[model samples]
Target: MANIKNPIIPGMAPDPSIIRVDKDYYIATSTFHWNPAVQIFHSTDLANWKLISYALTKGEVNLRGTNTPAGIWAPHLSYDKQSGKFWLAYSHMQNMAGREFNSDSFAMWSDNIQGPWSDPIYLTSIGFDPAVFHDENGKHYVSILEWETRTGYQAPGHIVIAEIDLEKGGIIGNWHRVTTGFTTRGCAEAPQVYKHNGYYYLMIASGGTGYAHGIEMGRSKNIFGPYEANPSGEPIITSSPHHLFSLGDPDSGHFEMYNPKSVMQKAGHGSLVHTTTNEWYIAHLMARPLPNTKLNPLGRETSLQKMTWTKDGWLQMIDGSNLAKMEVPGLRNSDATIQSDQLNNIDDDFNNSRYDLRFMTPYREQKSSWVNTTEHPGNLRIYGGNSFFSQVNPAIMATRATSLNYTAQTSVSFKPDHYSETAGLGLYYDSNNWIYARLCQSDKEDGTVLRLLQAKLGDRIDYIFDEVRVPNNFAEIKINYNLGTTQIMYKISENDDWKQLGDQLDVSYLSDEGVNGEPGEVGGFTAMFNFIGSVDAHQHDSFADFDYYKVINK
Candidate 1:
């Protein structure tokens, strides 16, 4: 049998919603503050997955000025077997000031999974983590966490369900309040509905999305009303299965609950599916820290757990433990040759007439006006937009940093007339936290130079004294990142030996819990991204031609 490993989809992929249609399985994940949101992956053997398409591709939502971890939340994908249509429900978290948590939930339907989806139909302004359930009677329902603003009420809120109308694009009636207390673990959200036998099961993510995160299940004979919690009185699956009383706590970083024994922590927010062969599995989000630290640079990733139903109709891990496993059994008779494509690295030549689907941009949609391959054949031509600090339009094309030890390199040809124009590669966590190695014009020397710039907690630090003069307009830039440290390097020619540009900088601050943000909240959730970007605050006419970009993981 194939031994399905943990983190099936690694690096910045979180809040996974999985579905199976026939023999094909598809998963949709959250993309906070990143354009082309709602990443979709397709798999056939359940052990390997590939990026197929994205949902919000055509400027469907405006993410301009979106803060870290405050854009797209959970995206729930489900297929209506009766109508033969795929439905996606997601939350656009607009604001989080004062813990008000203002968000709008919307749904879009398409005849095919990879599709020309219809415009987003407004569902509710209730809360985040919206999930759509297709009932057996041709009825549709939506489950969401109702944000609680009152002081004494439950901190995060309640899981509520309401019947929805697809054609009318609204709820049919009042929302039914489900039980908020699920196994004493608080901060419950991402409610998903599933029907089995003669009962309706409501699965939720509880104990926050931190060290104590887990998946809990409840079931009711009716769609809504008096759902009974799992008889185990604990999460069905978690990295830290130890008991804790954290009710009413809305904090997303439960550092005190960190389990040192498990390599995979923050395991929760799961989506379930039953294979055609009657085996069951849960696709959930997990994290692997940088060895001895609580900081997770890779962010939340997708992992799979083998599950089975009890004789009394309760779901539990296949091994009958609440602890999340790093390895699980796959198909009974399937070959074990399946492997993930993103485990090591990727190299893109930009020769294909189209941009790689794995490449994504933050704040703004990737359009040909600023980034395109057709402008210069066999090269990616990027016209610098705004500075790295601007959440409006930052001309950056990035992919997820999947490994702690990896080298990212790119060759660029640019001659900047002004000091504001720069082009090179860097490691980005958000607009406020990044380490950039850029090639720009030096004001003192009146020549091109390569320098390193960093932004930590909104403070900009420029390595002015360490700037290295480039001999020509063309240079190769590389960043070697190991654990929490990184070093920038560049070479003037293909045969020239690489020269280190700066000291080995400690970049552990570019992590989920290391940066600065709203009080009691994790700084960011999108994780580290290796990107090639340009900035042209001068005339916005300067462009950089990148011949290729590559990432090699050791």
Candidate 2:
């Protein structure tokens, strides 16, 4: 039997959309502000998952000043059996100011799950978290929340369905307001429809995107007709036990439903699939706040729960309950045979033919000019480009912080002749939030200096330690984050002897849940990334050779 473990997939993987083809299962996740968006994973067994490739790589959308948790929202993945093409639907939340939420939804198709995906085709302007359902009659239908900003409406933000004509780039028929998700606890979004056993089942995410989040279901005989809620009169899967409504409140469209008994805050936005062994599972997003604290560093990760059909023709957990977790039979090997803590290492030597899929750049395209693999055989040479704050571009490639307690170390040899060129290792949450131990040339003393700097979310330049004369040209930097606290250390050799450079920076604010503001208000969408970066603001050519980048879990 399979049991619920700690974290199925860790580190900023949210809004999981899973699909199974033959015996193979693939999962796609949302990457809000992170560039090279839409992470895809492959799995043989339900327990083990590995990074396959990213869906978006052409810089299809600009995300320079995209606010926290406001870039790319929920992404839906579906495979068309007729064309054998993988269709992906996502929402680019361009702006969320005044909580206006003017987002545009788009679609992309690829022959294979990995390769060169086509450019995005505009789908609808209808709210975020859009899903596509291809019917048996070769017709495609889309279901999404029609965000309500108008007055005189009974229930704002209702789940609407429309037939889509893929070639014409528009809807063919009228929009049907099927359900407002009122009976099963209001505030619905991320609607996915499926036809099974002569019935149409519509699953939606309801109860807001917070502690009271849930997966509500309704079924009907016709595709667009009167649907009946689950006979349980509650959510099929939810961490919250609160009776909330999204009906009367004006901003009820975006109201936060509170649930006092939630073990995992924000446990909704789910995708369903049947395994090779004919067992059903629901992959949903779940958040875990630090032990007794509300700081969630791993963000929303993918979690699975066994589900079965009820005698009343409704889907329910194996155990007749509203919560999502219970021990169930495994589809592959037994639960004891699966490893609980299996994680791919983050060590990189740049010896492969292509860059690691984990590495991602900020805003612009990845230029071969900044990084040269041909020149340095086993190393990566990163030339400084622009400061982190510049809207133009920045020379930085980073991977997500996989573990809360981990150490990232990198060796870089660079001669900083000007104040603009600097190379170092740091923890980067965003362009605004970062802390680096860098080696740069000081203009005042006319010599190379080692400095420790901290940049908050809105601040420009905030130096923690001024230019301190150390070995000027070549040095190694190590940043160790203890989850609760963070330390900056430096050394010049490969030995374990490291010297503490600056004060312990409390980085508890870097977690997704700890950052201030409401659900969609502020804070980064993903966790912080560990990176080796260089910035050249002087318009001069400077080379920084990084020997290796290694991350050790502590």
Candidate 3:
């Protein structure tokens, strides 16, 4: 056996939905407020995964004003052997204000996993985390959390199921209210159904997506009835199961439940799969907050753990430990070459015709104008459009800040005629929260100058430094995000010593729990990102040329 390692996929990759099509394994995860939603990954062996494609590529959904953690929710991926088709089901969470939880569910199909998937067919808005389960008898069923609008009811509501017609849009007849869980861990969601010998199993995420988060299960003889909880009444897997706390907490960031002993936190929302070797593993979402802080800058990542079935028809971790691990046993004699750890640093020279699959832009539908690689030949010419504060058309190319401690650097040359036309490097969390060190209209100088700025919870703080003068046209800008603090640095030459732009900025708030200052409620779960962007509100033609982009984790 090989060491598969925990968090098979990292950095804002949450709500994993895994499926095996023939010899290949596919996992689709949620992408909130990020365009080209529903990130898809492929792996020949369970241990090594690679980002291959995205499901909603043609601007299939509009997320222009989508808020943090409110764009695309958990996406369930399935494959039908009889039809040789791939199915993806997901929720477009539109609003979270006042806890309305207004969302719409839809499903799409593709003949190929890497595909031109069919237009989203409407599913239901009963709640989020909608999943489609295809029975052995060729019948399809949809399982979703029936969001409780009534205050006195089971707060998050029950897990409901109904036979769905994939060809059409709605359920066949009526939805049947199923079991919440074996026991009340509280806040049941992300319900996935599966079939085994003589029984249909319903697995759900419990404990409110925080420190107490875990996988809860129930089974029934029929597809949708009288389901019984696992005999233990506890979650099958979790990061913190030592004590149950915050059972009904509506907040996603249970920062109060930080487990000091655990390397992984918030381990829940799991999907299962069986390898060709006849081994079972659970793919789920987990988080790794900064040491001693409940701030999770990496957001929720995808993790895997081996499991087994009891003779009494229950699933349990192979090791009998509910705590999530940083390193887990890999597949038996699995392929190890294509793993994410293969590159500790990513250096892109803007040589490829298409942007690397790892690069992403928030709420952007790319065209030749916004981010043009051919306009300047080898340089990535980013034409400025909107400020980072807008989810609309911010001319930014960002990649996940995968490690808690890492340095992201890029070489950019920009001449901004006006203050509104600026370009440079940034560490962003959402449209509202971000830090930018860029070359903009100099307040004191005649030409463009370098300055540092910060935005916390949508409040913009500007001109942290006004003395840095860029004598050369190009500047190598870098942001060192170590743990939870961010240090901005710049140099005129690549070989020159890097100079600090401002004081070491505490960016602990660039986390899942940080900027969302809402009281008594959970915050957003989107991870932090490092980006190269240009803003030209004065005139849309102003552009920045980025020679290279690099991210190194040390």
Which number leads on lDDT? Answer: 1
Taken over the whole model, the C-alpha lDDT of each candidate is: 0.91, 0.75, 0.84
lDDT of 1 at 277: 86
Task: Please tell me which model should have the higher TM-score, number 1 or number 3.
Answer: 1
Q: Mind giving the per-residue lDDT tens digits that candidate 2 earns over 1-554?
A: 65545346767788899998887888899987677888899887777788889888887888776666677888999988888889899999877766567899988889888968888888888788888888888999888888876766643478899999765667877889998883546667889998878888999887665566789898889878688888767788877655665553323212244334554666778999987777788888877656556666667777877788876788887777776552334575555344343364578887865667788776655667787666787778888878876534777878877666888888888888787788888877666667778888876747777787666654655463545565647777888888557887887656647877767888776666545433444355476778888888887488788888888775
Question: How large is the C-alpha RMSD of every model relative to the true structure?
Answer: 1.1, 2.9, 1.8
Candidate 1 worst ten-residue window by lDDT: 336-345
Provide TM-scores for the models: 0.99, 0.91, 0.96
Give the C-alpha miss distance for residue 97 in model 3, angstroms: 1.1
Query: Would you list the rank order by TM-score, best first?
Result: 1, 3, 2
Model 1 lDDT per residue over 314-348, tens place: 99999999899888999888885646544547788
User: What are the runs in model 3 whose C-alpha is more than 4 Å off?
Assistant: 243-252, 335-344, 464-466, 517-520
Question: lDDT tens string, model 3, 353-460?
Answer: 876677888987767868878988778999998988897888878888788888999999988877788899999888889999998877754776788877889898
